[model samples]
Target: MDYVSALLPPVVMAAFFIALVVTIVKSQGGANKAKEDAAVDAALSRAESARQSQP
Candidate 1:
């Protein structure tokens, strides 16, 4: 019982960590991916325009 009590916290934390990772991975796909890619491309174009406008 002593060993089980000592080890339970790490096991619980590992489970929660795995769940959070899975959620993040799942969220990165589907409709959100297209929007995210577009936003990134827009940002890069804006940055390039700003650079060209400077030096």
Candidate 2:
């Protein structure tokens, strides 16, 4: 029916969005978590040091 057709796309998109979120959540905080965090910290520190040196 018209209502079923209208609702189907939204339902399908929501299901895929939920799956994507679940995959992202599961991929986080494993063996690479510390490595990723260190990389971020290093980048931030480098930026801060550069900003301090600018003036």
Candidate 2 lDDT tens digits, 1-55: 9999999999999999999999999889998899999999999999999999997
Model 1 residue 53 lDDT score: 100
State each model's CA lDDT, in order.
Answer: 0.97, 0.97
TM-score for each of the candidates = 0.67, 0.82
Largest TM-score belongs to which candidate?
2
Encode model 1's per-residue lDDT on 1-55: one tens digit a residue: 9999999999999999999999999999799999999999999999999999997
Q: Candidate 2, which segments miss by more than 4 Å at Cα?
A: none
Q: Candidate 1 at residue 3, lDDT?
A: 100
Off by over 4 Å in 1: none
C-alpha lDDT (0 to 100) for residue 24 of candidate 1: 97
